[model samples]
Target chain A: SAVISQKPSRDICQRGTSLTIQCQVDSQVTMMFWYRQQPGQSLTLIATANQGSEATYESGFVIDKFPISRPNLTFSTLTVSNMSPEDSSIYLCSARVASGGRGIQYFGAGTRLSVL
Target chain B: AQRVTQPEKLLSVFKGAPVELKCNYSYSGSPELFWYVQYSRQRLQLLLRHISRESIKGFTADLNKGETSFHLKKPFAQEEDSAMYYCALSNSNSGYALNFGKGTSLLVTP
Candidate 1:
């Protein structure tokens, strides 16, 4: 299990403003992922953050709207650019920890963003 | 493409009653299935995995490859079991990330 933390646990922002959510892991991980959970809905993978490289965004999500930066193995950030009311959602960060023969993924306490 | 499907959006059961949460997957290759639980105000955590074949918190799930299903089941429900449950799948050979289903909210009432 990994101890992960996210900054700005909850935030309210005006429309058209951008916010960057930070994810910090207690130990180095092989993979880091970003997800978005709409109210009363399921989680959607936003992107997969790769250290020292550009992140891979999922279908329906673009780099220009949600830019990601993973400078090191233990830290990553996702910036919601030019936000709108529809962009309000719980953003979660997860990491894969090597264990046994395979690895298990763990999630951070999500950042709940409310775009007004 | 790998995908997970949880049929129920909400399920309610009384304490000591049996509970079952259905989950199905669509993937061509071998899949690693998992059940994740989120309690109120707590971070989501892994409850159990099909590969491990270990029961956690009196919950057990068996992978039926023929049916492409991994349903979570328990004989007796408890009040503490009220929470959100998500079914996830990962390609055995693909990267270690998961494709999650729309979670099911379980309400175990006394």
Candidate 2:
């Protein structure tokens, strides 16, 4: 399994300000995903970041609101643009491990964002 | 539409007692199921997957395609087993990104 590291484990931001979260995997992986977990809610898939290409966003999510980047196999970034109070949640970074056979996704510790 | 449902929001049990966490999923194709656990102040980690048919930390889950469920179970509950458990399903069409349940908070008391 690949170890994922997320920067800025927690942050507090003002409304209308955007925040970018970084996810780094210890090894090269084929698939990277971004998920948002609202307070008292289940984790929802935001998008799948494809290496060397634009990310595929899930329903109810747009690239403008949550732009993603995967420049390489071992790294990806997700930015929550034009933030609001509702945007406050835990943002998780996950990767499909090459060795985990059958593409098991491993998650990062997640970034807790509080918007006021 | 692939979805994972964990009916119970929380489950409390006495230590040394048997414990079962129910999980149900909806998917048209053959799905892969998994159980993930998050201990206090720790990252979410994979506890077990149905394909492996292996028990992890005294816990095991059987994928019943007929019933559309993959409930996790343990013979004896341990205090340290208390944590947030999430049941997930892998949709082959979606690059294997997990569809997670709402999660069940298990509490083991003395």
Candidate 3:
């Protein structure tokens, strides 16, 4: 299993301000994913970040709103732009590793963002 | 579109009692399912996956292709087992990104 570290475990931001969360993995991974969990809601995929390519955003998530950067295999960053109260949620970073011919994902502790 | 469903929002069980967490998924392709658990104040971790057919923390889940369900079960529930469990599905169609269900909060009391 791969260990993951996320910076800014918790943050408080004012409305209209932006915050970027960083995810660092111990080992190189092929794919990294970003997810958001709102209060009392399921984890929703924000985007898929691949090294050396553009990110693939999920249906309801747009790059403008949630920009992602995967500069390398071991690190990725997700930025919540133009933040609002609705954007306050827990953001998680996940990396996939191959095991038993299947891919298993490991997650970070998550960054809890509170926008006021 | 792939979707994972966990019917119960919360499940309470007494220590040493049997426990089951229900999960169902909808997908056209062969689905790969996983059970992830999040303890209080901890990161989400993988408990088990259907393909492995191995039990972790005395919990097991079997995938029923006909009924499209994968339910996690344990014969004896412990107080430490209380946590939020999420059912997820991943397939090639969605680029292998997990589609997670609304998690179920398990409460095991002494």
Candidate 4:
């Protein structure tokens, strides 16, 4: 398991503005992910951050809306572009690490974002 | 496609009482189940995974493949046990990411 640190625990942004959230892991990992939890909803996978390559996004999400960057093995950033009131949610960063042939994912504290 | 379902949105029980949070998932491949908990003002943490076959904080969940369910149970609920519990399914073949249920909010009143 790895410890993750996310910056700007909470932020308030206006519609059409964009905000970037940073995620740092204590240990290097192969797979890092970004997830969003809307109010009163379950967590949804936004994208998978790949080191030194473009990210892979889920069906409902797009790179233009939620751009992701994995600069290295231990750090990644997710930028929510063209923010809207509907984009308000808790954004969490997670990393998948291998342990004894098992893959386990640990999550960060999450960034609470509100788009006015 | 993989999907996880948690039927109850909120469950209230008195302290020392037995508790159970139901979870059901739909997946085409072999299923991997997990329970994640989030206490008030706390980060979400893993409670237990089906593969580990272990108990945490007096809670245990058995994977029932036939039923496509992994329900979390506790013989005696404690005040500290009250939290939002999420049931999730992992798709190993798909590479990364997890499918999470809506979650259950447990309330243990003393």
Best by lDDT: 3
- Tens-digit lDDT string for candidate 4 (B1-110): 78899999999999999999999999978877889999999888999989999999999999999999999999999999989999988876656577899999999999
Candidate 4 TM-score, C-alpha based: 0.97
| TM-score (chain B only), all candidates | 0.96, 0.98, 0.98, 0.97
Question: How would the docking of model 4 be graded?
Answer: high
Where model 2 places Cα greater than 4 Å from the true spot, the runs are none
What range of 10 consecutive residues in model 3 chain B has the weakest lDDT sum?
Answer: B90-99
lDDT of each: 0.91, 0.93, 0.95, 0.92
Q: Give per-residue CA lDDT, model 3, range B7-60, as digits (tens).
A: 999999999999999999999889899999999999999999999999899999
Clashing residue pairs in candidate 3, if any?
none
| lDDT of model 4 at position A41 | 85
Predicted structure with the largest TM-score when compared to the true one: 3
Docking category for candidate 3?
A: high
Query: CA lDDT of B80 in candidate 4?
Result: 94
> What local lDDT score does residue B19 receive in model 1, on the 0 to 100 scale?
100
Task: Identify the runs in model 4 with alpha carbons over 4 angstroms from their true place.
Answer: none
- Tell me how much of the true interface, by contacts, candidate 4 captures: 0.82
Model 2 lDDT per residue over B1-110, tens place: 88899999999999999999999999999998999999999999999999899989999999999999999999999999999999999967988889999999999999
Give residue B72's lDDT in candidate 4 (0 to 100). Answer: 100
Tens digits of lDDT, candidate 2, A8-97: 899999999999999999999879999999998889999999797779999999999999889888999999999999999999999987
Q: Which residue segments of model 1 deviate by more than 4 Å?
A: B92-94
Residue B43, candidate 4: Cα error in Å is 0.8
DockQ of each: 0.82, 0.89, 0.94, 0.85
